[model samples]
Target: MGSNIVFSANNNEEVMVLPVVPEIEVNKPQNNEQFETLNNGTINLIGDEGLRTFSIASIFPSQKYSWLKHGSVAEPFKYVDFFNKWRAKKVPLRVVTSRPDGREWFNMPCVIDSFTFKQLRNGDIEYTLDMAEYRFIGGV
Candidate 1:
C-alpha cells in the first residue's frame, strides 16, 4: 500500500491556521496485555483489556510561499503556537493513512504525548509529534 498519510485537527473550525505537515508517519494501535506466572510453571493471562495506543510523527519543511504575500518564514512559529494550544487543551487528533492497495486506516481519539521542533542549517524547520491513542476509532 502507498505510505501517504494526512493529519487534520478534529476541531478545524476552532483552529484557523493549522500547521502544514507534509510528511507523516503513523504507527498502528496495539493491545495492552498482562500475564502472570503461576507457581506450577503455568502462565496465567491477566488484565488484557485496556486502551490501545499509537504514535504519529510529522515533518514540516521550510519553504517560501506566495500565500503570505511576502516571502515569509513564520510557518514554524505558527506551528509552535498550534502545537502548544493543542497540548495545553489536551485535545484529540485524527489521522488518515492511505495504503497502496487502495485501503485507508483511520485512527482517532489520539492524544499528544510530545512535540519536538528542530531547526536546520538551511532554515528548514522539522516538527515531530508523538501521540498515543486513547481509544480505538476503527479503520475503514
Candidate 2:
C-alpha cells in the first residue's frame, strides 16, 4: 500500500501525497456544562460537539530518500508555497485519508488554523500543521 494521506485545494486537479505517514492527533471536545437549578439541584446539559481538529507534525523532504513514501519527489519549498497560497486564499482545503483500496476513513474540508515550519540543517522542512473542521454557513 502507498501513502494514504493526501492534501489538495484544487479539487484533486493536483494533490500532495504525504512523504510519510504522520502520527496524526485528532481532537473534538464536547462542551458539556452544569448549572444550578432554582430548586438547588444541579442541571447537567450535553452541549453540541466542538469542531474536530487535526494536527500533523512532519518533515517535507528536500530530496528523495530510501524511506520516501510518496511516488514523486518535490522540493520542500513547493510544499511551503502551497500552504502559503492556500492560507492566503482563506478557503477550505481537503484532506483525505483512505485505505489502499480507497475506503476512506477521513475526508474533511478544513480551514488552516495554523501552519509553522523550520528549515533544518539538512534542508528538510519540519512543519507543524493544525487544521479545524469547517462548518458551512447558510447558502443562497
Candidate 3:
C-alpha cells in the first residue's frame, strides 16, 4: 500500500512524500514461560528481509533498472541516515534482525555506530553495543 507521508521543516514548509511503512503483526506466544521483560529504554529493531525486499521492489518494479534508477539506489542508505537523525533527536536504537550469521559485514560503520546491532548468530540473537559509548540527550 502507498501513503501520503508528510515531513515538516523548521522553515514552516511541509513536504509531501511517499514512505513505505510495512505493517507486520505477530502474535506472541501465550505461554508465560516464553515471555521476556523488555526494559523501557529498549527499542527492538527487527529487519524483515522479506518486507524490505517487497518494499524495495514495490518502489522500483523494473528489474532492468536495478540500482541505476535515480532514488532507488540511494533509498536503502536512508535507513542509516535515519539512525543518525534519530540519535540526534535522543531516541535509543536497538537492532533485531532475522538475518543469518555473518551478514553483519554489509553494514557501514557510520550507521553501525548509532545502534546496538543484534542478529542471529549460530541460532541465537547476539548484541553489540559499541554505539552506546556516547551519551544520549535523554536517559537512554
Tens-place lDDT digits, model 1, residues 23-111 = 44445434445555666555545444555455444444456654332222345666666667866876666655555464775545567
lDDT by residue (tens digit), candidate 3, 8-60: 22222322121321232222222222333566554444533321111111231
In terms of lDDT, the poorest run of 10 residues in model 1 is 65-74
User: Once superposed on the true structure, which residue ranges of model 1 sit more than 4 Å away at CA?
Assistant: 14-40, 46-50, 56-58, 64-74, 136-140
Best-to-worst order by lDDT is: 2, 1, 3
Give Cα-based local distance difference scores for all models. 0.54, 0.83, 0.28
lDDT for each residue of candidate 2 in 1-140, tens digit (9 for 90 to 100): 64478888857755777786677778989989999999979999999999999899999898888887755454888888888888898867889887666688788878888999999999999999999998768851
User: At residue 58, what lDDT does model 2 achieve?
Assistant: 90
The weakest ten consecutive residues by lDDT in model 3 span 51-60
**Clashing pairs for predicted structure model 1, backbone only:** 1-99, 1-100, 2-99, 2-100
Give stretches of model 3 more than 4 Å off.
1-77, 99-130, 133-140
Which lDDT value does model 3 have at 139?
A: 59
Better of 2 and 3 by TM-score: 2
Deviation from native of the Cα of residue 116 in model 2, angstroms = 0.8
Instruction: Give the clashing pairs for model 3.
Output: 45-96
TM-score of each: 0.59, 0.86, 0.23
Report the C-alpha displacement of residue 63, candidate 3, in angstroms. 11
Q: State the displacement of the C-alpha of residue 54, model 3, in Å, after optimal TM-score superposition.
A: 28
